[model samples]
Target: MMLRVFVTLKPSVLDPQGMTIQKTLAGLGYSQVEEVRQGKYFEIRWAGDLSAREERDKVETIVARVLSNPVIEGYRIEWPQEIPA
Candidate 1:
């Protein structure tokens, strides 16, 4: 199975990179842009027999321990509807 993880800074945390990008966009004539928030995307492929619940648990552990910073970051997992042939 394939899984995707998205990690982003919590709303309360300041995002300097995002701000910079937003400013750049505005300078580039994208005046309508209000804000930009940056995040990380990870695609993982697991070939195991683990059940759905177990897989979720394992992925959550990985995300919490290594994929994202618990202090100021939040993460979510996505399961694609169709696997590539």
Candidate 2:
């Protein structure tokens, strides 16, 4: 199964990189742009026979322990859905 994790800074935290990008965009004539919050996305592929709940638990553990910093960042996990042929 494939999973995706998105990590981002907490709302109260200041994002200098995002601000810089926003300013650059404005300078580039993208005046309508308001704010940009940068984040990280991870795509993980796990091959196993684990059940859905088990897989979700494993991914959650990985996200909490390895992927994100609990103090300043937040993360969300997305489970893959089957695609019809």
Candidate 3:
């Protein structure tokens, strides 16, 4: 199974990296750019007999507790396919 994790800063927080991208795009003629926020994206792949819901919950928990800084960051998890026995 493949797991995709997105770790992002909270909306209230500022993302310098994302801001840089936004400015660059604007410089490139993307004048419509209004805002930009950047965060970390991680991918983990595991093959196991665990259910998708169970695995997803696990991943979320890990992100909330360990991977992400709740003070300024939020996290999301994605699975490409359901677990099969």
Question: Evaluated with lDDT, which candidate comes out highest?
Answer: 1
Q: List where candidate 1 sits over 4 angstroms from the true fold.
A: 80-85
On residues 24-78, what C-alpha lDDT tens digit does candidate 1 reach at each position?
Answer: 9999999999999999999999786335667667878999889999999999888
lDDT winner between 2 and 3, please give it: 2
Write down the TM-score of every candidate: 0.87, 0.87, 0.75
Q: Each prediction's Cα lDDT score?
A: 0.86, 0.84, 0.80
Ranking by TM-score: 1, 2, 3
Model 3 earns a TM-score of 0.75
Write down the TM-score for model 1: 0.87
- In model 3, the worst 10-residue window by lDDT is 76-85
> How much does each candidate deviate from the true structure in C-alpha RMSD?
3.6, 3.4, 3.1
CA lDDT, candidate 1, residue 80: 54
Question: Candidate 1: global Cα-lDDT?
Answer: 0.86
